[model samples]
Target: MKATREAYGEALLDLGRLSDQVVALDADLSKSTKTSLFAKEFPERFFDVGIAEQNMIGIAAGLSLAGFVPFASTFAIFASGRAWEQIRNTVAYPSLNVKVCASHAGITVGEDGASHQSVEDIGLMSIIPNMTVLVPSDPIETKSIINWAFKYKGPVYVRLGRMGVPDLLPKDYSFDTKPYIFKKGKKIVIFATGIMLWKCLEAIELLKAYDIEPTLVNIPCLKPFPEKEIIEIVREHDMVFTAEEHSIIGGLGSMVASTLSRSYPMKVSFIGINDKFGTSGKPNDLLSFYGLDAAGIRDKLLDNIK
Candidate 1:
């Protein structure tokens, strides 16, 4: 098991080796965000902005303008909340090649309380024009997405969790904006993102005993959502359920619901944090408490179907 943030740190190191133009900036959270790994190897190229997220973003924007591919690392709350204006005006407005890869996003940032946990980072970043939002399911996919972000010239926000999760994708899996079909079933379709994908997979197994089969789709890309594929997939199922470690209001659930409501118009249920702040606790315990665990998901599905 590995955390996506770990993959991000390794990816940054690999990127640094591939291109000298690649630079990293952190808001005094290098150790937590794992950007310290990159800082160790490339001290000159790495800048620790010291808790000043807004200034860190401005520096990154300046680096981008100077023909450098700057990757800014920080906690999700500070990246999306504290430095949102700087990101919107400086980097995203100009559509610069600045990648803001935030770690410890969503309820998974357990024991940190609501202030540190970011449940609306995706929605906030997605609202900005030219800002690409991505959430990788596992470590392998995170590396792949980081590679893609480097190749794509624009502002990007990649959400990564703090907890170590089981790998769901194959070792050789490459990053693609399209949704990945983990399993094919007819009655219902479950769309999941981030760490919720693992829980959804476990829920599918438990569903087998109840003779309830559902298709599982892992949505790695949140913004520039795969609408065409989602519409096609929903056409084959009776209902759709979106699961994410975010608020149901404007995260993955809202994106999927909006797409289906416009084109498909099917019964869509959302499994996520329902307009509530996260509290301090063990990550696994928090997931279970909020009905985001495997058993919890299975029970919710059974209730909705029946």
Candidate 2:
């Protein structure tokens, strides 16, 4: 198992070696955000803004204007909260080649409590007009997404977690801006994002005991949501469910619901943290407490099915 943050750090190092124009900026959380790896390998190309997320974002925007691809790293809460205006006005509005790679996102930022946990980061980032939001499921996908972000011109937000998660994608798996079907079924469909995809896979195993066969989809791209594919998949299933380690309000659930509401609306259920703040605890325990774990997800689906 490997944390997505670790993959991001390694990807940044690879990107640095591939292109000198690739620069990294951090808000004094290099060690935690894992951008320190890039700083170590390419000290001249890295800038530590010293606890100033807003300034870091502005600097990244400037770098982008100067024809450089800048990657800014920070905690999800600070990147999407503290520097929102800078991100909106400086980077996103201009549609600059700036990548905001935020780590320790969602309720999985355990022990740090609500202040550090960013359940609404995806919502905040996705709301921007020119921003492309991405939440990779595992280490391999995280690397692939980072590579994609570098090649794609414009503003992008990549959400990553602190906890180590099991690898769900194959070693040679490449990422696209579309959703990927992990398991195919007919009774119901579950669209999950981030590490929740892993949980949904486990839930599927338990669901089989109850004679429920559900399709599972991994939504890595939250913004520019795979509308056509989602509509097609929803058409194949009787019911739909969206699971994420985020608030059900404006994360994957809300996006999927909005897409389906316009095209193929059905019995859509959400499995996520319902309008609440997280507390200090083990990551897995918090997931279980919020009914986002495998067993909890299975029970929730079964209840709705019956």
Cα lDDT, all candidates: 0.93, 0.93
Please provide, for model 2 over 1-306, each residue's C-alpha lDDT reduced to its tens digit, 9 standing for 90 to 100.
989999999999999999999999999999988999999999999999898999999999999899999999999999999999999998888798999999999988999999999999999999999999999999999999999999998999999999998889999989998889989987699999999999999999988888888999999999988999999888888889999999999999999989888887766899998999989999999999999999999999988988
Query: After TM-score superposition, what is the CA distance of residue 14 in candidate 2 from its true location, in Å?
Result: 0.5
RMSD of each: 0.8, 0.8
Candidate 1 lDDT over residue span 272-296, tens digit each: 9999999999999999988999999
Instruction: Give model 1's TM-score versus the native structure.
Output: 0.99
For each candidate, give its TM-score against the true structure.
Answer: 0.99, 0.99
Residue pairs in clash, model 2: none
Minimal lDDT window, size 10, model 2: 259-268
Error of 1 at 127 (Å): 0.9
